[model samples]
Target: MSKEKESVLEGFKAFLMRGNVIDLAVAVVIGAAFTNVVTSVVKGVINPVVGAFGTQDLNMYSSCLKAPCETNDAGEVVKGIPIMWGTVLSAVLTFLITAAVVYFLMVLPMAKYLARRARQQAAKEEVQEVMEVSELEVLKEIRDALVAQRGSGRNDPGRNGPGQSTP
Candidate 1:
C-alpha cells in the first residue's frame, strides 16, 4: 500500500485500540441490555399497578382530537383523528423509572463513595505535609547548629580565623 493509505489504516487501528473506545463500546452494549430490563419492568410491573385504576395497557388510552373518532373491528382507527396520549404517558413513565433507578442505584452510591475517598485522600495529604514540614524544621535546626559550631571553632586560639595566616 502507499504510505498515505498505510498511515490512514494505522491511525484507524490505533483509534479502535484505544481504551476509551473499547470502554464506550462496552457501555453501549450494557446500556442496550439494561434498557430491555427497564422496559420489561415498566410493562410488567408498572402497567399492572396503573391498570387497577383503568386499562392494563397504557397504549389503550386515548382521546378523540376531531369529531367522529371511531375504531374498526380490529381496533384500528377508521374514522376521525385520535390523539395517542396514553402511549406518551407510558413513555414518560418508563423514562422516569429508568432515571430513578439509575440515579438511586448507581449515581448516588458512586457519588458518596467518591466523596468519602476524596476526604480520606485530603486527610492523608495533610498528614504528609505536616511530616515534611517537621523534617524541614529539623534539618534547618541541624544546619544552624553546624554553622554555630564552625564559627566557634574559628574563634578558638588554636584555629585560624577568616584571612589570618597561620605562622
Candidate 2:
C-alpha cells in the first residue's frame, strides 16, 4: 500500500511539472481578466451609445404580466402586459460585438502565426530526413565494397574438402 501511494504521488508530481499544464493555467487566468474588461466595455460604452438611438434603456428590457410592470405604480388589468425586448436586443448585440473582436483581434492572428510556424518546422524536419538518408546510403556503399573485396581473395588450404587427410 505504501509503494502504491508513493507511485501515485510521483505520477502527480510529474503531471504538475509539465509545460502544457502550466501554460493552460496561465491562459485561463488571462482569459478571465480579459473577459472582465470586455464585459465592462459592453456595459459602459456600447450600451449607452445604442441606448441613445433607441426608445428604451438597454437594462430595462423584460417581460412582465398580471400587474403594473413598473414596481412603483399599480395599474388596472385593462393595460396590456409589457414585454421588454430591449434587454434581449442589448444582450444579443453585446455577444456579436465581443465575438467579432475576439475573432479578428486574437483568434485570427494566432491561427496565422501557428500555421506559419508549423510550415517552418516541417521544412526543417524534411531537410534533416534527407540528410540522414544520404548518410545511410554512403555507409551502405562502404559495407558493400568491403564485402566484395573479401570475396575476391584466394581460398585457404584449411578451407578445402572436409574429407581430405590431415597434415
Best by lDDT: 1
lDDT by residue (tens digit), candidate 1, 1-167: 89999999999999999999999999899889989999999999999999999999999898997887988899988988999999999999989988999999999999999999999999999999999999999999999999999889777778887787787
Give lDDT for model 1.
0.93
List the candidate 1 regions with Cα displacement exceeding 4 Å. Answer: 156-167
RMSD of each: 2.7, 7.0
| Candidate 2 residue lDDT tens string, 113-146 | 9999999999999999999999999999999998
lDDT of each: 0.93, 0.78
* Clashing pairs counted in every model: 0, 1
Model 2: lDDT of residue 99: 85
Give me the runs in candidate 2 sitting further than 4 Å from their true place.
55-57, 65-70, 73-87, 122-167
TM-score of each: 0.88, 0.58
Global lDDT for candidate 2? 0.78
